[model samples]
Target: MIRSERNPAGDPSGPTHERVFRALRTRIMHGEIIPGQAMTIRGIALEFNVSMTPAREAVRRLTAEGALSMSKTGR
Candidate 1:
């Protein structure tokens, strides 16, 4: 039950990766996610009803953006 709504700039919420990234990024930016919290790919995938690929991508992007910190084991 994904929506196909597009923005004025023609950007649509059509990609699961982007959608997951946006959702996680938003939560991090809004301080919804506690600091030093551990997050797993499988957990995120299950929470968003998406695959591990998208969740992994979102996590990597967030880590790159400094929104999330990775541990030594890359959790």
Candidate 2:
């Protein structure tokens, strides 16, 4: 039951990661991100200001949905 100022977006519903993942998913599904866009964990991490873990999970979920294709070389 602790209140914090971390929610500058005024979204008191939940954490920011979920919103980021949703945006990421939409972008990927709509061809905004593009396949073979060379998205690194660090790049995504930086892009969304999320740690490697959540970013990784988001990517994994996207991969599972077949919206994103992962290659061996990360290219």
Q: Which candidate has the top score in TM-score? A: 1
Query: Per-residue lDDT tens digits of candidate 2, residues 1-75?
Result: 543333424666455556557888888768899767888867887887767766777777777888777788753
In angstroms, the error of model 1 at 70 is 1.6
RMSD of each predicted structure: 5.0, 3.9
> Which consecutive 10 residues in model 2 have the weakest lDDT in total?
1-10
Backbone collisions counted per model: 0, 0
- Computed on alpha carbons, the lDDT of every model, listed in order, comes to 0.78, 0.70
- Shift of residue 32 alpha carbon in model 1, Å: 0.9
Question: What lDDT tens digits, residue by residue, belong to model 1 across residues 1-75?
Answer: 443312212446656778888999899788898898888889998998777887888898888888988888777
Give the poorly placed runs of model 2, Cα more than 4 Å off: 1-17
Q: After superposition, how far is residue 68 of candidate 2 from its true place, in Å?
A: 1.1
User: Which 10 residues in a row give candidate 1 its minimum summed lDDT?
Assistant: 1-10
